[model samples]
Target: MVRDLDHALKHVSLRAPAPRFERPRPPRGVFTSQQGFMRALGVGAVLLVAVLPFMDASRYTMSIATSALIYVMLCMGLNVVVGYAGLLDLGYIAFFAVGAYISGIFTTVLGWPMWAALIATIVACVTAGIIIGAPTLRLRSDYLAIVTLGFGEIIRITANNLKITGGPSGIHGIPTWSFGPWSFDDGFNLFGIDFPERVVFYYFVAAVVIVVGVIGAGRLAKGRLGRAWKAVRDDEDAAEAMGINTYIAKISAYIIGAVWAGMAGQLMATHLSAISPNSFQFLYSALILMAVVLGGMGSTPGVIIGALFVSLAPELLRDFAEWRYLIFGVLLVVVMLFRPSGLWPATAVLPWLRRTRPTPPAFTEATAVPASVMESVDGTPTTDAHEGDRA
Candidate 1:
């Protein structure tokens, strides 16, 4: 029986159509290949122009750049929460307040080092994240936003009434960020560039911090946790059904966002040598959220663009200071109406977007057979024999 089956299979193999695979053809035209080298070249040129003049720019310009960079960092952090996790946090400024207060207390009253203060600021912000995110995240969407908004106001009010936080007077004379020997207050000489010239040191520090934050956010977006966050963002119910712990994922997003905001707070405190409840107002929170949304929520580059627009648009329109906010509001509304995806939408477009592998030629019964009949055992021509031989 085995030998007969093998003989039948051999016959079938001989008569069956050949199976083959074909390679895919390259796409023609309308292609947008990633050019990282060219992108890097353009970015390098822009940075050189923007930064090389820092040693000579006026104090006002340097201050503006520093503030803009800080905003960029904050937006990236918030992007993780809103953009990645799809959580709308309205009181993000609360974390910034926590960081500034922690840094202020550690540096001014406790007489600890600035680095130590920064570390403590992060810890405090993380603690704040848990304390706030725990009970509040239990609520869905709009309610969560309201709770966060209330929490932010609560933080600001507490800071206003607390003595350690300097009450309404706020904290003053907060020390500059420093390492073992390099005091940020004493700006270093970059080649011939003096650190303190027009407060260039702050810009230098801010640039480093922004770069680090951007890189970290990008890394997080591509890591395992990032995928989970995105899964939750896309569909919380589905993600939960798939065994992802939505609660933990949401909490992680808040903690990361809080830490980022805290760092920005530290930068703000050092830049102004002060901390105030006014600094963490609802307007600032809205502004940061604006940067994230206007840029491209989940996109790092988009968020950077949004931050620059939010920060520099007002500065550039200083000549029209009377209508600056009006113009800004108009521009934002225009952007949302026309290009709702964002200034740079995260959608990736390219030629031949669909899979383009060559398909095998299908053979039918008539096509598979030659224009001839097969003979039976008696040598009489037979269509049945030919049909059977067609396999």
Candidate 2:
């Protein structure tokens, strides 16, 4: 049988197969081509903000810039809950209010320094986030939004009824940040330029805080936690299948967002020297949410750009009067119509592309020619043989 099979195989002929194997490719760095461009844009923005106050910028200019920075920080915080974790929160302003209120209570009522008040504000925000998130994080879509909106209203209404919070009039006489003998309230002269008011110093301080917040948010968005948040955002069921605790991941995002918002609230309280229940309105929440969506969700640069536009567009178009908002609405519609997923979408890179070591496929299904295609006269099988003439 063996001889017959061998004889039959000898009659079959085919071209020799070529030797082949995959060559190892180096893993791509974390910074993709487009990401590099965004880095450049961020650096330029930082430099511009840093030098603006020194370039004969008017008081109004610094004031507007300061407000824009606050929005940027708020939008970035929202980016975590809405953008990264994919949670729908309509009452995010509640956290902002909580932070400001906590700081205000600590400073004006409790006689705590601004720095210490800031610490208390952060703790309170984080705690509030957990309390709210524990109950509502499981909800999805409109349900989540409605629940959060209710929670926000509950907070504001409660504040309005409380004497400690100073009722509807809110807290006042909030002091600027100070340490030891130094206070941000004091004016200073730098080089040939003299800052006559606290606005310039406040502008510098806000710039620094905003820059740090942006950097921190960006880092969080790039870390392991960030990936988990994105995973939950994409598909909670699938993410759970992959062993990710969607609930925990979601709450984590909420807490981070709350902390960021709280810090921003503290800044707002000090910057304006007061906090009112009216400031934490539903409209502000809507606007912050809009800024994140208008800019690219999950995109740091897009959020910043969106924030600047939202905060400054009103001032820039003031000449248009009431028509300005109509025009702005039209422009927003146009932008959304053109780029729906935002200006910069969060695209996932392949494992091999993002990791230091590329993972190989486990097993490949065989779909080619069968291993044994013919049987010899002696009842022995022969490997693939091309049809041909035989003696």
Candidate 3:
């Protein structure tokens, strides 16, 4: 019986496994990949911004544009915390307040140059970030958010009460950026096209800061630190097991975000030549967080769009007078309803840009079995019925 079984096994031939179905790849080209396309779009946007003042250098236009750029800076920073690290910060504006107030005090009270004041602002923001993040980052989700909210309120109240911060009235006459003898207030002529203080400030200072901030945030999101942030965001325990220090990742994100917000605050103070407790209210914090969510967290392009929409939508709808805010709220609700993941979610792909490929046919049981496998050692095909009868 053993010899007969061995003979039968020798007669049976095994077939190789079926080939795996591979999806067809799109043709390689400059715009074929998402990253390449985004790069091109970013270049175009920068160029457009460079020439925008030439089109309309009006005070109203520059003011609105500058404000939108400030929003962009703030949103980018918040994106690092909430979007990348998955830390919900409800009191982010506190860092902004810190930067503005510190700069204001250094320049106006201490009679320091804007450059010196800026250095102070950076240090103060970093310290504030550590103070707030060190204690609160241990808490996750809603608890973290609540603590941040309280911290924001504390900063506002402190500013309102402190005489150095000008009390409730806040600081005014904060000087524009300057380096020794040269100053932004002096303005400059380029290519025989003379520019005024407002134009020079908007073009050189605000635009440059915003561009640097955006690029810096984007770079950070693509580096090793960014990977750790994403890992911690996805699964803290898994990341910890993989040797990532979640605490350090969270704190780094918080600190970077604080510095970004602080720079924006300094810019704002110079733009308006003032800083008040009323400006850093809880409402502004909520608005900044909303912009991050609305634009799609963890997405650079989406965040920029969200910031612009949140900042410009009100002004665009101002023709409606008192009904503008109502319309704006309705629009936001409608957008969220339709695109819950965000208008441009991190995973989103345009239909037209998607790779086109025919669907492969599904596998079936009939195709799984080979004819040789059903044959007997005697060279006669054997069916289940025949085998059962013989048994």
Candidate 4:
């Protein structure tokens, strides 16, 4: 029996041979080799903007770009609350209103410096975040959304009725921003192109701030805190078991989001040189949220593109006037229906961008032995030869 089994095993091994080459595979993670492509795309975008003045940098176009940049900032802020933390905050524009009102007061009424007013704006937004986020964050999903919506309305109404906010007339004649010897009202000639002083400076300023915010949000999303927030987003129970404080994480997301929005409001106040309660209406909040969703929630590039479309599309369709909004609504609905994940989904990368692929599986070595050793030295077989025979 042992001799017969040994012959059968050798025959099977000879018939089915293992591969000649075998090696362990490489580990997986976000690749650094693709950084060059990312950098190239970024450079290309900047170059396009730098050349915009050459192609009719009219006041209208520049102003549109400036407003689009502000919307980008707002969309990024909302992305933090909705995309990263998975919180639906419908009242985010309230923080913008608060910042505008607070800074407007310091600059217009008290005659404080614009820089000082900016500081006040930051404080007001942070305070508002804690005040609103602290209590509402304890609730889940729809309830939280409803509370935030209410908070937004309350802020708008308060601004409309308040004495300091200038009632319905709102604040006007707010001073232009300046830093030391440099003023936003100053213009310079470059490459034979004469740009408007105020518009050009704020355009660059808003662009810089938007870039910084994008980079900051990207870093935060990949950090330890970001992972914790994802944990809370994915499963609260599992995150709690893993020792995360979900409540604190949610509130922190709100505060960070609010700070970005406040800075955006400061930009707006300086750009318009005046602000009204009408500027911070519920519709504005809804619009910003729409930008975030349409751009691809949690994606920086997607959000920026989304913001530009939302802000600029209607302006470009000004000829249609009344019909423009109807067209806009239809476009959004179409986008949502077909590309529910947004135009540029957060998980997607350009085709030209190639990250390193995962390594292949390794081969294992198996020994081929004579069936004579299959016996336990007492005439019984140590192998499952009988089972194979039964099969």
Best by TM-score: 3
What's the residue-level lDDT of 331 in candidate 1? 88
- Give the per-residue lDDT of model 2 (tens digit) for 1-391: 6676567667655344432444445433335344555567677877887777777567788777777888888889999999999999999999999989999999998899999997898899989999999999889999999999999998899999999999999999998887888777676678876775555655665665556678888889889999999999999999999999999999999999999899888888877888889999999999898889988898887888888888999899999999999988888898899978776555633344456454563443333223342444445554543322221
Per-residue accuracy of model 4 over 118-146 as CA lDDT, tens digit each: 88888888899999999999998899999
Instruction: Single out the weakest 10-residue window by summed lDDT for candidate 3.
Output: 362-371
* Candidate-wise lDDT, in order: 0.80, 0.82, 0.87, 0.80
TM-score of 1: 0.80
Write model 3 residue lDDT over 1-391, tens digit each, in one string. Answer: 5565576667776566554544356444546766667777888888888888899999899888888888899999999999999999999999999999999999999999987888899999999999999999999999999999999999999999988899989998999988778888898898999787888888765565556677888888889999999999999999999999999999999999999999989888998999899999999999999998999999888998999999999999999999999999999999999988887877887564677554565543222434455454445665654345558
Candidate 3 regions exceeding 4 Å error are: 1-30, 358-391
What is the lDDT, from 0 to 100, of the residue 123 in candidate 4? 85
Worst 10 residues of 4 by lDDT: 25-34
**Better candidate by TM-score, 1 or 3:** 3
**Decoy 4 TM-score against native:** 0.81
Candidate 1, residues 28-97, lDDT tens digits: the string is 3333233343356447745763664545567777788778778888888899999999999999989989
Report lDDT (Cα) of residue 346, candidate 1.
Answer: 63
* TM-score of decoy 3: 0.84
TM of each candidate vs. truth? 0.80, 0.79, 0.84, 0.81
Which candidate's lDDT is highest?
Answer: 3
| Residue pair clashes in candidate 2 | none
Q: What is the C-alpha RMSD of each candidate to the true structure, in Å?
A: 7.2, 9.0, 8.1, 8.6
